[model samples]
Target: MASLNVGGLGGYLREQRRTAQLSLRQLADAAGVSNPYLSQIERGLRKPSAEILQQIAKALRISAETLYVQAGILDERDRGEVETRGVILADPTLDERQKQVLLQIYESFRKGNGYGADDGPAGEGGTSSAGTADAS
Candidate 1:
């Protein structure tokens, strides 16, 4: 768990929006921000206020805590909600197919464990292992 950096948050949000198949216009509409402003924020040319972050979170259908993490306002320990299973999936060693499979498994585990879409618990067995799953 590390303190989030504002630049990191901006990058993460942009990536998340892209991964969700959302255009800047679409995400801006959802977040209730102007498309140009959202684009600027995504490009690291602007920093969103906490209130704007909250609105963006609402539009993304994710917890504001996620935005906080992105905005560098909170560390992982301060995350009130929003499980970050994708962090694990984002390892460079993982190919796109592997990422997809892991994401699916993680989502299934979340569902089986009574986790909400936004504030789900992370882990297939409520635990983490440092060992590599692949030798390559």
Candidate 2:
């Protein structure tokens, strides 16, 4: 996914915090970040890394991938795949190698069924970057 500067992500974080009935200071403390830093993030004056976003998401009890999508760290079209990968990566029982192997299997299955990395889910009218039908 193409990385973008923070703007919508900041606003979205603010909304999520409010919806969770949390104040900036409360969320900052819960997320183990400084209040000022979190305020800067909410004001769009800062870009949070994926780790920081994950901490904030945990504090808000929301999906980290949602913030990742808002921050442009992950593409909306790839949200589901990325989410599955995230869950696999975060599993306590799976070792690194197992996680990687599982991910590879998942990728192969998707590609085998005409859902390659570049292709959307079925019935999405897969198109190439050039805006043409998928040649393969």
Instruction: Let me know the TM-score candidate 2 reaches against the reference structure.
Output: 0.71
- For each candidate, what TM-score against the reference? 0.53, 0.71
In order, candidate lDDTs are 0.69, 0.84
Model 2 agreement with the true structure over 1-136: per-residue lDDT tens digits? 5676598888899999999999999999999999999999999999899999999999999998889889998878888987888899999999999998888778776765657676776667653333322333
Best by lDDT: 2
Q: For candidate 1, which ten residues in a row score worst on lDDT?
A: 127-136
Shift of residue 71 alpha carbon in model 2, Å: 0.3
Mind giving the per-residue lDDT tens digits that candidate 1 earns over 6-114? Answer: 6777788888888888999999998889999998888777878889999988877777887887777765543632345546555899888987777766656544555
Where does model 1 exceed 4 Å of error? 1-4, 80-136
- Model 2 lDDT, residue 28, Cα: 100
